[model samples]
Target: QATAMSVDCLGQRAVLSGRRFLYIVNLDAPNEGHRKISRQSKWDIGAVQWNPHDSYAYYFAASSNQRVDLYKWKEGNGEVCTSLQGHTRVISDLDWAVFEPDLLVTSSVDTYIYIWDIKDTRKPTVSLSAVAGASQVKWNKKNANCLATSHDGDVRIWDKRKPSTAVEYLAAHLSKIHGLDWHPDNEYTLATSSQDNSVRFWDYRQPRKYLNILPCQVPVWKARYTPFSNGLVTVMVPQLRRENSLLLWNVFDLNTPVHTFVGHDDVVLEFQWRKQKEGSKDYQLVTWSRDQTLRMWRIDSQLQRLCANDILDGVEDLIDGISHLPEPDKTLHPQDSEPQHNSGHGDEEALKEDFLNDPLVGKKTDQLGLPQTLQQEFSLINVQIRNVNVEMDAVSRSCTVSVHCGNHRVRMLVMFPVQYPNNAAPSFQFINPTSITASMKAKLLKILKDTSLQKVKRNQSCLEPCLRQLVSWLESVVVRRTAWAFCPTLLSSL
Candidate 1:
């Protein structure tokens, strides 16, 4: 029986490990092209993963008993590379680094996490002692030197520079953790699935508690972040049923799944998202099950579009007003004495109906009496506005809006002159203190000013385009700086 499976980063092939043999299938023609490579192992394979950095290398590792066997694919056959031999106990999980192609991390039941340089397999380059025996390990996608390990009911985050200690520890669940993964877009965010029948999202920077929790009646085998969005996919065994348990959820809203994939007849051992093909709008989800079969589920444009809308809608519900608290509080506020509508506390049903009836349902920027062409272009930007507070000054013909992006907040103050959208340019300034560097802040302001002047010269609206440019700059800078800072000193030491 097959116990472990993984898809390569390029999504061209998949590898499945059984009791004493490895099977390789070309995803393009899965059924017609299948090859089996025999291995000398008495027990079943525990875990497997392909090298995620290089497409031409085609290297993979398979763990069994107390050792991990490395293999390279060439001409439809797997050739044995060196076997890494350091763990005294069974190897539980392994992962390749996102930035460094030769770096690999492995966790074992020996209560240790080992980082190895595949080029020199004599011994592990770094060893981290864990609080308990680890069952899973995953590298952060947005951070090069940061990684996480799951042991017992807790998850630990480690910086490669300080291998002797963990940077943060979170008591995630009451039972053993089965899976752990970092968010693709955010460096501090991560998700964990446990045998305790719940999946929780956490921000390591704020370790006091989890951000969100999704409770299921059955054990969730794995929970992973989607490649292109904030959605999550999980494989679980439903309360009384043992089949068809793949579910997709919007992390912001746990009330319901956006879609459920139902094709597998037995418990799914592992599943991965295939890289989207060129010019293809749909994404493929591949799964291997205990029923001795592999299946692929296609998520079309309609479903993806719905998932995106659902994310924005959920954010609107969570943070519609400036004073809206993320969590409910029983303590009364002074503003509660005023009328509900004026105080931004209208009926929930009425708010929902208003959102449904709004003409700008899927738009990023709200209507501001701009031209039709300019309005459509501004709406096409793919940025999520967590919260917005607009202050309008009719006497001065000015507007100040505070926008929230991931962990960074920005405030924009624009003053429209008497000859706006005709000849004179609007004055723009960034008011709030952002965590970004001074140089980045200056660059953003310069871009905003330049764009505003260009719009004025063309005799068009400027606020919408300026906001869109700001969002784009914020996202790019955050992702790049965070990933660079995450590379530890140990990488240089090596």
Candidate 2:
């Protein structure tokens, strides 16, 4: 199997592809090396390009036989977690719509490019057949609705919202279009690479035009805009070595190459510009070499913001959970056709006026965006947590979580409203833990290791029995339960 080729960072989590598996690292920890998150994958992690949003996110893989599988990495400890299904060939490259989190685009060797509604992993929402030999794909970041692809000798763009070929070109290239990428900050600016040993830039917004071409003797295998940085491009070339080399490009003047990096002897197979933080242009840079090395690069200078096509060093947090934007609802997150632009200049004022009138704006919400309904049910809690012996029994038929804080002799319960008629009241709930996080869980585990418990010892493989016994004793027992109590109020705050 191929060694890990690329690893992309998104805040604490970094998605790594290689060894026929995906590894996610919550790098935010003080000792991230000790914590590992991984899963075997049925997809080929490309030499460059990791998921743009979440670390577990993956769309399309290089086809081993006939079909490419796209997946959403599920982080819980459960079977049937990872979601997959996409293109029918080696998924050469893919990208997700940023503004709309649920949309995915992919291109493959089968000569077909497709889009998916990751919101529903069961099926592909849109599929558009492309030219034969088409093997590259990239989404226009400036316009998530648009996608571009290159095949044997053509470069094409399609409106994802449309079914027919809205934009096409037969005379776009003289040879196979090997690489394609769109500018991160600008919608019209695009870069293309070819087997003809040349890299070219184009501005699609300007009546279908090619801005400039930079000559190169090597095949440009991958190219992309450095996430969040201004006017920077990182390209991977597999010419002299199977590993790869970094080529810096100036989007304003693509005809001239500014810098070429030569650090690895083997093929430099994968490269990713660290996302987040503008000042850390060169910070968090990562690359894989065939020589079995996954090295990190830090920008040498802080004064210089832009160097070559990569940002300067030390900038991080670009992937820190997209700036908390005022979204209408979760529905808009994955399939929002477009964010409603401020109708007039005083959008700020307009939003303030609207927010003041929104009934659910500042209040705690239930599963249906309504106030949490109150009802009582003292039923069974039967959700099992695998080998961990951690389970969430529906203490009642309602949505209530019982958190056991090992120390301080304290336990808290956050319960939600009752399920309504028609199974359609749609009680709004965030399944993600309220008071507990992965990091918090990890810390508690560490504490368990240090504390006195039934199963305390070295190299004891299973802690389920011990943890279950501890949790059973620590559960908060309230005799009389009502909706108007502190438990319900605290539950709604979550």
Candidate 3:
């Protein structure tokens, strides 16, 4: 049910990979002029990608089984131009070089990564072996020779120029990596999502520790950087298989997603950005779901602003506002503007100085050392934790947390002060429906108070962590009681 979808860099068309066919749709008019190319294989396409060059706009690649097919489409006709075959096992993923139109890379379960030249489909031009099969392969957008591959929990960085071994290695995760993405602007930076229920950012140069981590309640299916602003898009595998899980996040503020895209009745299989057209301020996100539907959402300037980093705000505003300014008078002769050119150059320096001096320009940033607001913390809290329920009222600065473990039930009111999470802890009160005794309630209250104090002293959000602690404590209590109740009977039977 998970189909692969790819949008061409030109943004004029998209290709969807299906079990028995490949469907190419005109993005500008999705309901019309669509063509489906039949696949004669039992193996579904594992990965699909469109060539990132404008000149090769009609060219795309799809991987099936151990082979990869290159498709060429023009006007109303489309067909497979060639097939690249070398891997001994199933090919897992493929990617086209961002800087080279003729080059394509494929990774396989055969423990080999092959780089193919479309001009010569007889054999691979270069092959790199990692001794372990790779689940994903991605070409660096900023560097043509650089590529990265994910092998289980580890990542290997490769430079095509030197194919003998990985130039750098990172123990990225403890579980299988589901997705790998290179930063659009930085060559050494990348993000890896895994079954470990977290997405970690890496500089690669310093592999000992991650730059930042985004903890999630469910495994992240994919994490990718947006082409505009300091934004990131993540696809999560929710516990309820078909729940809405597409989220748009600000990279600067990782505590919460800026917006969540809801509407898909089933899980989203793939998503890609529609190339932003010239003179347009809006970007579109195209997604394909397990429900067998394709949906596109427009991201206007207003949404883009929410993802903008404070340090980049001034630059983004300058670029967007330049076109709105009136065009200079072309009627004036070149000789008539000589004095104005000199005066204008002088004014430019003064304007730059004034811009820098303005207090409102590039002065605010995410690292302002301020604690998060109650509403922001509430937005960041995970509501899907098992056997736990939290009802938060931001206006009242209070929340009711309920946890059920075995036959025990706990319902408590957690009230926060005005200066919460800034050396100010919330007070927990056991309420109706609580099944624990007075001694147990007091113990739980002390644990909750200590947990909240630990985080508040550091000016951090503690509500979610405290809730998780409550669940763990209750489960331990239940397990101990069950063991004690059955221990004597087991010994007598023995």
Best by TM-score: 3
Model 2 scores a C-alpha lDDT of: 0.44
The list of candidate 1 runs beyond 4 A from truth reads 55-57, 238-243, 309-494
Q: Summarize candidate 2's per-residue lDDT along 291-312 as a digit string, tens digits.
A: 5444444333221222222211
The alpha-carbon deviation from the true structure for residue 394 of candidate 2, after best TM-score superposition, in angstroms, is: 82
Q: Tell me the deviation in Å of residue 91 in model 1.
A: 0.7
lDDT for each residue of candidate 1 in 1-494, tens digit (9 for 90 to 100) = 67888898888888888876788878876645467788877888898888886553599988888888888988888977988889999999999888898888999999989999989999999999995889999999999999999988899999988999999998989999989999888788888998999898788876667777778878888999887554689988555554455777655445445555654457888999888999998888888777666667667543453334232334443333211111121111222322111111111111222343563454332222233332232333223332445565646677776766567787878788777767677787667754656776676787678667766665655664566456645653443234211122211211
Tens digit of lDDT per residue, candidate 3, span 1-494?
32788999899888878777777777776654357787788888889998989999889999899989899988867799989999999999999988888999999999999999999989989999999999999999898999999999999999999999999999999999999999888888889999999888887887767777778888999999998876789999867774454777766556555555654557888989998989998998888877666667667664575566543354544333311111111111222312111101100001222233452553322222222588766654656556988899999999999999899999999999998867999999989999999988886786678667866776766786578568756764664355311122211221
**Residue 303 accuracy (lDDT) in model 3:** 53
Model number with the top lDDT: 3
Ranking of candidates on TM-score, top first: 3, 1, 2
Q: In model 2, what lDDT does residue 116 have?
A: 66
Instruction: Evaluate model 1: give its lDDT.
Output: 0.69
TM-score of 1: 0.65
State TM-scores per candidate: 0.65, 0.52, 0.67
**What range of 10 consecutive residues in model 3 has the weakest lDDT sum?**
341-350
Candidate 3 lDDT for residue 108: 94
Candidate closer to the true structure by TM-score (higher is better), 1 or 2: 1
Model 3 spans with C-alpha error above 4 angstroms: 311-494
